[model samples]
Target: MVRALVVGATRGLGASLTRQYASKASSTVFATTRSSVPKDFPENVKWLSGVDLQKPKVGDDLAGQLKGEKPLDLVIITAGRFTTEDFNDKGPNWDEEVTMYTTSSIAPVFLVHALFHAGLLSKGSKVVLVSSESGSITLRHESEGGGNYAHHASKAALNMVGRLLSLDLKDAGVVVSIIHPGFMRSDMTKGVGFDKFWDDGGAVTTDDAASSLVEWTEKLDISKTGEYWAPRGPGDIGTAEATLGKGLSTPLKLPWRWLLRKAISVILLRDTALVWSLLRFRTRTAIYDKTLFVKCGLPLAVPADQDAGDDAQADDPDGHATGDDETLAMG
Candidate 1:
């Protein structure tokens, strides 16, 4: 039998996920809420009330509640708080930013640590951190402009936390998935004045998003752990076309690796002596490993061998200095 826990399960995607898991035969579902249990919440689903993610002791409270239960097969943290911000007179509210960060990023670390220490998360356990496309710097484009700093940055921090947790738990056979659950038509969105974009933004019902997430979770494994994904694809990502280009596919994976590549390219471009040393040592077996070049910072196509003649060719590819070689030599 599978045991699943859905944090922040009073409403929206969390509630839907809890109900979905509870509906499955031979599956036990647990849910956490900051307030008292809702009247119509699924009878089969166990509830942990007064579980506020903003509080420092939230993790300990959860661990205490599920102390002796079977190890959870799945743990989904969906507690999130978003507040709009801008450079106008209203500006960014300090309280809102702190709350957003605490709920979305800081709390999950403690919650996962508590679970791991309590033996609630064992081998083969799947931990899903619900992030947002707003977390993606690549996805942010001029089209959307700027605002909601706290909401966006908080999710970004959550993504980093998820990645670190994955590395820490990899040896334990735990899979941590960071995901941007699709934009949804819920009170959370409505509260943030995003309802205007609901029609144009391709926002779906929370239940629909939950269904896609549940299906995706069922298929998730160690091979793709620590990756950020959008189970409903780029349909709702407004900047997908402007930022990532068109002709995209479903289960849209965020391009974090692209950022790493760009960073490496910047480093190689900035460090002239490093590139020069690499070129000089190209012939040496110890230094000229093509795999190492690929992994490190060589974004350009590398020739098989750079003999004296090839070096001459590279230095003056068009039979001219091109200034690049002169700059490299000066370094």
Candidate 2:
């Protein structure tokens, strides 16, 4: 049997992936929930309770459940919490801050350590840790200014854990991956009051996110170990366009192809404006040359008068003649 475990499989991506994995033939899926067992667990899928990742012993608890079993084919840790922070709270609230890191970042280190020591993950097993792009230091831009200090930093630390885990597990032929499951519409996001960003942030349903992740995980091997991926691609990632450049990283063709075309049109319009300005400048120069010849009596028909005008200018060498010349040019 292709045995797979979805850690923290209570709701959202974890729950959806549990259902997705069970849909496959010849697969027995195991999932974990903290306490509540939604009455709708999939048939043939086992649920493990008391698996809070914050506690290091939780891994040992999980190992006890799957003890004596074949090494797991896939292990995914998806249990995490996000906490909002205030920059000016007068003082930092250590409890919530610590809980955020413990839940999202620190626990995965020992949890995986426990499982590895317990022999729950065998050679060729795939270990997937659900990390977010929020963890991506590269993806951070000025658009998302602010605090969620632990929430963001924990994921970054988790990414580092994944990288280290990949190195440690490589000799055993185990593959590890850290991933951004796309912007998901879930309780974690909603609870943190980010629901207002749901639509604009390109947030997707957990089902869609799970489908992409399962498909990607199914094909994962050592070649992709320690790499981060967005199974849904860049469609829902708000920073992708700004950071990776428009259209280049998205799942579909750029939604506003016209915007690029409009940009080109503006450039062409600018060039045309420049050409028109240059033409007007040259035309004015030619007109001024013609007018000066006439006004200064330098035209072929007035060359004799030009000498008289020059003589007239010599007569008022002081200033009157120069003023007259200026008046003639203006006229």
Candidate 3:
């Protein structure tokens, strides 16, 4: 049987994802909620209510509860908080930024770590983190401008979290995916006053966005682990066309391969620096040789045509040329 766990399942995409999983007869779905009194969820779904991701005890409690359950077939952390910020606002909102970073990125580490240790995660398990395209530095364009520093930065940090987690889990045959779950016309967007741009933003209903995300997650495998993708594809990404151009596909490659490429780059740079230093050293040695000869007022060496014998000994009485050759060799 397929066992699925969806965290932060009270509303929005999380709720829809939970519903999708519950609809499958072969699946036993578990969901989480931060609320002590969350609106009732479906009867088929097991609810882990009061599972606040911001707190460590929450993970400990949840891990203990699921210890005897089947190694989770799937785990998706959908907890996220977005707060808009602009230069016009009264400085930066430190509290909101911390919430965004902790919930969206930092919490996942401890949660996953605890679950794995508790035997809730095993080989062939898939972990998904619902990040956003806004996290992508390459995807950002000047046309959209910038204001939500915490929102964007949190997602970026989450992407790194996913990458490192993927590396850690790969040897165990577990796959980790980071995804932009697509834009949705949900209360979260409305609360952020993004409804004004809803039409232009190509926002869809939460159900529709969640459907695509569910489908995308279904296709995940250990081989495709450690990737960033948009479940709904580039169609919904506002900056996709502007920044990435057309016809770009994602879930691309080994996330750590880029670091390998960078290491290769460093080697190349080191070789280049070494060559440059040697050239500089040689030039300096040549300059010093000329200066030394001039400063010492040493007589020029005998012409090549002037063969040695008694005359050569008389010309280099001080043996300065021999000492100069030794200096050049040392240099």
Candidate 1 least-lDDT 10 residues:
322-331
Using lDDT as the measure, what is the rank order of every candidate, best first?
Answer: 1, 3, 2
Quantify how close model 3 is to the true structure by its C-alpha RMSD in Å. Answer: 16.5
lDDT of 2: 0.74
Better of 1 and 2 by TM-score: 1
TM-score of each: 0.82, 0.73, 0.75
lDDT of each: 0.84, 0.74, 0.75
Those runs of model 3 whose alpha carbons end farther than 4 Å from true positions after fitting are 250-331
The parts of candidate 1 lying over 4 Å away from their true place are 260-331
Clashing residue pairs for model 1 = none
Top lDDT: which candidate number?
1
- What are the per-model numbers of colliding residue pairs? 0, 0, 0
The numbered model that scores best in TM-score is 1
Q: Report residue 61 deviation for candidate 1 (angstroms).
A: 0.9
